[model samples]
Target: MRTSLSVHDLSFTWPDGSTVVTGLDLAIGPGRHGLVGLNGSGKSTLLKLVAGQLTPTTGTVTTAGTLAYLPQDPGSDPRRTIAEVLAIADTLAALSRMEAGDVRESDYDVIGDDWDIAERTAAELGRLGLGHLELDRTVATLSGGELVLLSLAALLLRRPAVLLLDEPTNNLDGEARARLIEAVAGWRGTLLVVSHDRALLNAMDDIAELRGGEVRWYGGGFDAYEAQVAAEQEAAERAVRAAETDVKAQKRDLVESQAKLASHARQGRARAARGDLPRILVGGRKRAAQVTAGRVTGVHQERLAGAASRLDEAEAAVRDDREIRVDLPDTAVPPRREVLLLEGVRPAFGDLELDLDVRGPERIGLTGRNGAGKTSLLRTITGELAPAGGRIEMKVPWRYLPQAMDLLVPELTVAENIARIAPDASETERRSRLARFLFRGRDADQPASTLSGGERLRATLASLLLAEPAPQLLLLDEPTNNLDLPSIRHLVEALRSYEGAFIVVSHDERFLDDLELTRRIQV
Candidate 1:
């Protein structure tokens, strides 16, 4: 197979001298590849190195043909038009000038061979469910999910031989996600995508896992990769058990050897005390016995050390993926208690009208397309934005965890941030609660600015669930965005014990399924 992209001894380190990836080598052929790893495993950093967005500390990256990269944010000026963002504005303008009979040599040069660039761009946008979008439309007018799709459309229009996408399905709605998945499935070039979305990863031809600064390839998609890892983990656990047994046996042998040595020494002492032979003869026998005892003890000690080393290796082979565990009994509402009431509510953005009542510990999921007013309705409920019409009544204390995760104060530590929200919580209480969210000891003291995507989500969740007056009504918007697969599982585990009523805005169907949502509200 021809290698479309290759990395040789690639290494990268931050300005603070913290290493991300070291001595990493990878080769990608012409196929759709999925990159899976825990958060902070340097998946995005490696992609940036491959795309030449960041300089590698050492070694080189080689690409066989043109390359295009779509970063997690894919930031673009809000004022820029779709045409300009797509890199075809000049060609379109030149074509217009030629049509208007004001063509010049410079215009002809700008047009090049992409005379049908406009039609091609439109078709690409349509493929990604952006057919309604106009080239003259400003990016500011698009929703976050729409903007993401628009950026993808721009990339596909270029027809690059190598494409790198970081979390491409993050902000996309169900329809948009399906479209993107279809595009990925149909991609003919070498495509590498870093994503935690199981549906998206399942669309890949192969899976590449980055762990401990090394890349390991799996033969098939996400399910196949998971099966292989599961088998490996099972073997590792068995090895660990066997090693433990061996270590225990070695300890028993060493103890027996020591006991036997003590017995021999006592016998020698008794013989010498009885004057069974000349003093010289007795001394020589004692020395010989001592040497024999030393040799036997040495053999047992060597066996014990070897067993201990094997045990260590076996334990190290097993994965330690910790989970978040917490109890929120205080947040529970009575079966007949009305947690929230929305009466003919009309949000500020979309034209959808809603009348809903959340009672007791109901778990509700909000589903909609981009710009369909899901977030607007959430903001309206929080009173951050006044509803255009109708009334919102909250009978219990409520807290909102926005998609942006803006709850934390960057300069404050995780503990400090939690304290800011729950002032009545004692320091011990704060630390204990944060530990349940997997932030313990110095991790609780680290500044919020230093948190990875998963850590930040955990911190934000701890703040919300640990807040004073104990929120009985919770609102979460896109809670799983940018979180790794393990982080998402952790979030689900944390929520499993939550007894409060919640209405979550998310496009992740898998997450909603995990939550076992009682009702799905379409906005």
Candidate 2:
């Protein structure tokens, strides 16, 4: 079998001297491969190293053919035109000059063999649902989802043999996500994607998990990899149990051996004291008994140590899947309470009139296309943006968790950020509340700028729910964008205990299903 991408003894270290990956080797053949791990497991770093965006500290990355990379955040100049983003502006300009009969020899050279490049670019954009966008339009008018798809389209136009995408579905809506997944499913050559989106991962031919600075390969897609991991965990748990039992038995044997040795020593002392034989004979027996006792105790101690070592190894194999446990009784709204009422409400963005009467703790899933005004509706409801035309009557306190998660002050610690919302709470109280979200001790003191994607989300959630008024109605926008699988699960666990009414805008079908939403409203 031939490999399209290969890494040999690859190692990378930050300038701060912290190593992200070391002695890592991977071989990816011509197939779609999904890369998954925890938030800080270096999946993106590995992808960048392989794509030649970053130089490795040691070792090398070898690619069989041309490579194209779609980064997680494909930042672009807002003033750049669509044609420039698609990388066909020069060729299109050459074609334009030729059509006007003003083409120079350099224009002919620039056009090269891509005579139909404009047509091909248009078709590719149409396939990615960007047909409505004109080539001359600046990217400033496009939504976040549209920008992501445009970046992907640019990569596809290159038609490289090895493609690397890092969280390409972060801001996409359901429709856009489907288009991206379809493209991934039909991809030829070698494609490696770093994503937490289960739907996107399910389209891969294989799964590569980057954990503990190493890459482990598994056959098939996300479901298959999950099943395999679950089985391995079960076996590891059984091993731990068996080793624990062995340790306990060894401890019991050691105690019994010590007791028997003490009894034998006492008997020898008694016989010697009573002059049962000559002093010499008694002394000799006493010395022999002492030696035997020492040997027996040594044997038992060695056995116990061995058992303990084995138990440690067995326990190390088990994974820690601790969930975030929290209860927000104060946020609960009464079943008969009328939480919000929107009558003929039109947002500032798209022309979608929303008329909603949210009662009780209704969990609504908001669905829409890329350019739809779902976020605008949420902002209007939260009074962050005035509605273009109708009335919004909010009977209870409400809070909005924006997709960008800019609620926290970057300079403040996690606890200090929470303090901004809960000013009356003491430092101890703040930390105690933050601990429920898994920010314990030193974690609670971490600066907002230093947090990982998952940690930042958790901290933001903590700040919202722990506010002074205790928000009864919550609006969440794309809450699971860049979170890893465990973090997504943690979010689910936290939401399970939240009693408030929330409208979450997400493209993740699996995540929405897990929420057991009362209703789904398409914007």
Candidate 3:
């Protein structure tokens, strides 16, 4: 196979002597490869190095063809239009056409004799779903999702040999994400993608994992990688358990040896102190015994130290395999006739009717295409925005979990947040409530700012339950946005058991299917 790119003995160390990449080697020829790893695992760093944006500290990276990168967040000039950005990708092609002396006097009257190139760019734009966007409109007017779509369209228009994408599906809705994946899959060039999207990874030819500054290539796609990871994790766990057993045995043996050596030394000393033996002979024997005991003691100590080090290494492996848990409080929500009423709840935007009829004990899912105003409807339901011609009446307790997860106070301790959100509770009661939510002891003392994404969600749910009256209505907007697979699974399990009325807005098909919402409203 021809090598499009090669890296040999690639090693890099930050200024702090920490190895981010060491003795790493990779070779890729014209095919799709998916890179998967945990957050902060140097996936982005490696991509930057591959893009020639950063030089390797101690190794060489040589590329045979031109490379282009699309970052997770595209930085587009606000003053440029979609067409202009697309044209940027065709600069070389346009220049080549300009140099060919193909300009006709009549053709100049239309697209200045470059009408062919412009037409090609226009077609590419339409293919990528930016056909409606004005070519001269400022990029600032585009939403975050729109920016990503336009950026990918521009890069593909360039027609480079290799394409690099970082979390391209993160901000995209389901339809857009599907379209982007299809575009990449149809392309006949080398592609390296760093994403957590399982579906996208499954579309690749191979999967590679970056862990502890090293890479392991799997023969198949995401499923193969997952199996390999599971096997490795199981092996590591067994090693940890075995090491702990050996360490415990070693500790007991060391203690026994030390005690025996002390006993021997004492006997030797007593024999030397006796006047019954020839003085020289007694002294020599005592010295001999002492030397032997000292040697044995030193050996035992060395063995103990080795065992301790092995135990530490095993413990580290256990820590790495540990999964983050998301456990929320289980509150009592009384069965109500009508928790909230959204009658004729016309939204502030969009062409949809302001009429939405909902009753208690219903799990409703709001689904729609991108820019369908799902979030706007959510805001209106939460009373953050007043509808132009609708009414929302709450007959029972209610709370809203916005997509931002801003319910918890970042500056305060989790315990403090619980207390602040429920001021009528006593200190003991607040602590007890937090404990029930799996934030017991020192965990409760952690600042909300220090929580992981899953932990923050749990904290918010705990606070709501701790209120004087448990909320009968629960509204969640994209609650699974930043969660990992396991966290999402845990949330689905919890919601399955929840008794309150639920209304969720999400574009995740898997999540919605698992939720088994009773009603689907497309905005």
Every candidate's lDDT: 0.90, 0.88, 0.74
RMSD of model 2, in Å? Answer: 2.4
| Top candidate by TM-score | 1
**Candidate 3 per-residue lDDT over residues 1-523, each given as its tens digit:** 8887777888866443445688899998889999876544577778878887767898988787788898765777888866676665244345545569765454334344444565666777677676788766888667556788888887886678888888677556787878878887887888999876778888899998887777879977888878877887788788888888877887888889888878877776787677667888887887887788788878877877888888788777653422323233343345446667776776676555546555656788887766666767778888898876777887777888876678888889899998887898898878876765567788788778656455677788777656656676788887775454555666777677667778888777888899888888877
- Global lDDT of model 1: 0.90
Q: Least accurate stretch of 10 residues (summed lDDT) in model 3?
A: 319-328
lDDT digits (tens) for residues 1-523 of candidate 1: 9999999999998654668789998999999999988876788889989999989999899999899999877778999998888888888988998999996999978987888888888788888988998889998878788988888888888889999999888778999999999999999999999999888999999999998999999988999999999999999999999999999999999999899889989988998899888999998988998899989999999999999999999999899888888697889888869999999999988877999999988999999889988888989999999899999999999999887788999999899999898898799988999999888898798778766677788899899899988999889998898788988998887777788889999999889999998899987
- Model 1, 190: alpha-carbon shift in Å? 1.8
Cα lDDT, model 3, residue 330: 40
- For TM-score, candidate 1 versus 3, the one ahead is 1
Stretches of candidate 1 exceeding 4 Å from the true structure: 57-59, 411-413, 423-428
Which segments of candidate 2 are over 4 A away from where they belong? 8-19, 49-65
lDDT of 2 by residue, 1-523 (tens): 7999999999998654557899998988999999999876788888889988889999999999899999877889999998999899999888998999996999978887889898888888888889999999999878889999999999888889999999899889878888989989999889999999888899999899988898899899999999999999999999999999999999999999899888887887888788788998987887888888889889988999999998898888898755776787889999979998999999998778988999999999998887688888888888889889999999998888998898999989898999999999888888888888888887787788756666788889899999988999889999997789998988887887799888899888889999999999877
Q: How far off is residue 2 in model 1, in Å? A: 3.5
